[model samples]
Target: MGQMRRRGTVAAGIAALVVPLTAALGGATPAQAATSCTAGVGPYQKQAEKFLGRPVDGKQSSTDCTSIRAFQSKHGITPAAGYAGSVTWGVMNLMNQQKAAGKTPNKAGTCPVNKGRIACVDLTRQLSWIQDGKKLVYGPVPVRTGRDKYETRTGLKKIYWRHKDHVSSLYDVPMPYSQFFDGGQAFHSVGVSMWNPPGSHGCVNMTKTDASKYWSLLKTGDDVFVYGRKPGT
Candidate 1:
């Protein structure tokens, strides 16, 4: 077990990767843009799956489409036909909308940290700390933020679940000791090269030392806080 710590002050700061979705559409043929046969050969399925946490199998076979469509509608983007062709490509170009939704999957103060010696995230300082009933246990280590078009998540919340060494195809990074609080987001590790302000894939990235230290101290139901945005914009 690790040493316990007290809750500290938190501020907002940010980081992450930028794969442009429009580029995917500009290269596709016109025919591929309108045909929506569901499933197979399209970016929609892939994007939707990443958004929904399940396989779409070229068909709207689950609540996946509903979730995807809801996200798209909420952001005022046309939902892809669950395919990877032209339509999917076109919709993807408006990924800023998707990225924004990814940031606020849960409302502020919706997932408050239960007062029982949990973890906390300070987005402004790009730090994560583990506490033990007002005492410090883990850290205040340096972390990275979202890059590309992705925006790292923020707001008041606490971790409810954790996964050890979780890998994701969508985020394309291995989240060591993944702490899932809001939908599809977690505490994880990214390449050291991404050490600047915005060098993550939406989730906050931390150094091995900080992550390992906190990993040992943190349990499932800990308090986690998030705030801040990219350094400048």
Candidate 2:
């Protein structure tokens, strides 16, 4: 599976998915002021400072705000207001765990290795990747999956449809690079940060770049294995 484009016939007559009114729209909550660092010390200021390698003083300094804000912005933490609250702190913790995984994200052997070409989604860590046997094909990029009641269904499935430029019939939001692997719970690129809270209605949300890469790399019938439970949901 050396980057070969395997074209397969698309499944026709698949019902257009209508997600819940709460959140099928990918860009429903865009962080507009992600760059503006606020002026106050957050509840987790000291923890954030330590995580960012800044001074361990509990007070919020200008430099600390800027650094914490940068981390929040980079990870798509909401408000992006430079506050080191629990959400920001939680994301920092996740990043630390992922960093420890390094190049071999599948070291835990959760994802099936025998599948020729498969998409591996680790909902527990909110990360995804493409693999060709033992070779890592695409990324172990950060992702946003379904929230609470609409949790992304786990188990092995195959890509049944591919809609490069898709708009939700119900939500009317753009779902770019949409590839339906499990009913309405497709893999699509959204406009918000992958770390955005409460997650999607059911879809696996990816960044624009990551979704585009997946669209180019995978095709209908490709294996998609979603495992583990998302942190909150």
Q: What's the TM for model 2?
A: 0.76
- Candidate 1: give its CA RMSD in angstroms: 15.0
**TM-scores of the candidates in the order shown:** 0.47, 0.76
Q: Per-residue CA lDDT of candidate 2, range 102-143, in tens? A: 557788888998989999999887778889898877677778
Name the lDDT of candidate 2. Answer: 0.75
Model 1, 1-233: lDDT tens per residue? 02333322111111122222223345433244334323344445666565445574655542444444333432334444433444333333323332332233222332233565765554443445555555545555556667658776777666777777888768555788677766677777655632233256677676555565666777676666676555545
What are the per-model C-alpha RMSD values against the true structure?
15.0, 10.6
Question: Candidate 1's C-alpha lDDT?
Answer: 0.50
Winning model by lDDT = 2
Cα-based lDDT at residue 90, candidate 1: 36
lDDT of each: 0.50, 0.75
